[model samples]
Target: MCSNGWIRAHATYYGVNDSPASLGGACGYDNPYHAGFGAHTAALSGALFRNGESCGGCYQVRCDYWADPKWCLRGAAVTVTATNFCPSNNNGGWCNLPRHHFDMSMPAFFRIARRGNEGIVPVFYRRVGCKRRGGVRFTMRGQGNFNMVILSNVGGSGAVKAGAVRGSRGKTWRQMTRNWGANWQSSGDLRGQRLSFRVTLLDRKTMTFLNVVPSSWWFGQTFSGRGQFL
Candidate 1:
């Protein structure tokens, strides 16, 4: 377990009582509800946030004792997904912590920390392969002549660094712009054509899916790709 990459940090929570739409942060995720939960999501500070590049990345965190010796998890750890950013302005300067800090959800923090300890706990964390249940999903979100696609449920590296699209009859791959979050947009019309995508993970790994979107595909539709980044 110590062989993988890891970081030391402090943990905290947000949206503990009610879920906010912005829980998806700047990633434009279609599943804000899950992002709002403490069990599966976390917020990273500016350093670890990687300018949103860490979106969808997964990590396993174990609490380290700093204050009261009475509350300690010993070595318990919990896994969480990168779903939001923890701005430096929050809560007295904890978020302003070094690049290694993490502001986790209550459920995630509780899972590693003892029953109570002023809500702040030191932790040892490391990036881990995201465990997705099925194939990756591409959700279409544009008008008739334009295309804005959101990539989600990606396994492994999680966030996408670059992406391209090609029409059923086209030979060249058209680059897509990272509009925000996981949403990528094409500059031209892609109507009447089945669509394929090529994605580059943050780690520089690449994957291409042919005809993942059928010619009959419409705006707001979602299609499942047969493969995922390992």
Candidate 2:
């Protein structure tokens, strides 16, 4: 991290690999290689440092995720990182899951995930982890009840739709396109369908879009999705 003036660097310079097999003899220029390329980014980076192994000499501090009220309306872009909890099912991890594509004429929707319980009152925001029918239920914990909700299919047109919230008392409210919640689940069925959607704060007032689904994401066994913050 950097402040008015700050600096950082290598964990320990194992120095350089001088082994003959390591990009050696000035004849392997065509073949570029990195150690443990197969390991997770975190694991791979950590792999190189052993015994006195260090993650990154001058590392950065970070949070898994967070939300900012200022981000909601300050032209901040909301990004949704989708991760299917169960990979055996059709859902893929964030990087692999299909970006819910939709036609301009077709209505878009939101999928909030809340996997815990802590009596969370629903307001609207870039991300919400509410329960849903397409899959498992939403999770809640302290003020985080409504933290991970995300909007989908939002575009150049600034239009908003309000539909009755669906799901159990503590579940995500499914806002339909025409105030009709009945047809919510039975809508068009497409693995690659793109829907028109946008991210809004809990009040359903302040809103923005989480850019687009990322082509790739840092992963763990139980990663989550919805519009993400900076």
Candidate 3:
């Protein structure tokens, strides 16, 4: 890590300018546009992905103009959300293990580097708080006794550490386990009851979204909470 809190890393671009490829990613945010991340997103390397734990995290990245003036746009930077993973390649890839890399979307890359230099550019990145417009969202999935909640539009730390769910008929909250990426799963049958969710961030701050999901909610529907983390 750099003395200024920024860590030295490298960045590259993928997909076209704000294409569909940058939408649904490993983070389970089917459409980043509706998920509140927009097109400013990136696929993190293994070093930073932390086995999907780093999903929904935010980072501010800037090109190191001093290192490569030709490709790096002077004093240019962009903030992006972690939405996907860049798997390591055996053929000596930049996203290989032990190396921190950000495979940014083309639009996000153009904000910190000139066009045509889509390969790799030295950069400095630092974790930052995510600023979301609305409250946290939970997209309901699965059926019957199995329920998966995909958390999104989270603010503050932007990464969930733990989650719990409670039906209107029950006073106890069922602990949710990490299924994949930002998705948390609960095996309890919650059908025909209003749903409430409690989310805990890495900072240990917890928030309870009371009755965010109505009793009529379906598998493919999404519900928004009334509050957000600061």
In terms of TM-score, the best-performing candidate is: 3
Off by over 4 Å in 1: 1-4, 19-22, 32-38, 66-68, 97-99
User: What are the per-residue Cα lDDT tens digits for candidate 3 across 149-184?
Assistant: 999999999989999999999999999999998889
- CA-RMSD of model 1: 2.9
Count the clashes in each prediction. 1, 38, 0
* Every candidate's lDDT: 0.76, 0.20, 0.90
| Candidate number that wins on TM-score, 1 or 2 | 1
Q: What is the C-alpha RMSD of each candidate to the true structure, in Å?
A: 2.9, 22.6, 1.7
- Residue-level lDDT of model 2, residues 1-230, one tens digit each, is 23433222111001124322123111111111221111111111112122111111111211112332221122222122111111111112211223211100000011121223121111122222221212111111112122121122222111123322222222333443321100122122212222222333223443322212222221111112343321
TM-score of each: 0.87, 0.16, 0.96
Residue 80 C-alpha lDDT in model 2: 21
lDDT of 1 at 116: 48
- The TM-score of predicted model 3 comes to 0.96
Tens-digit lDDT string for candidate 1 (84-201): 7777866558778464667777777777777646767677788887777666788888886678998888887887899999998789999998887678999788988999999888
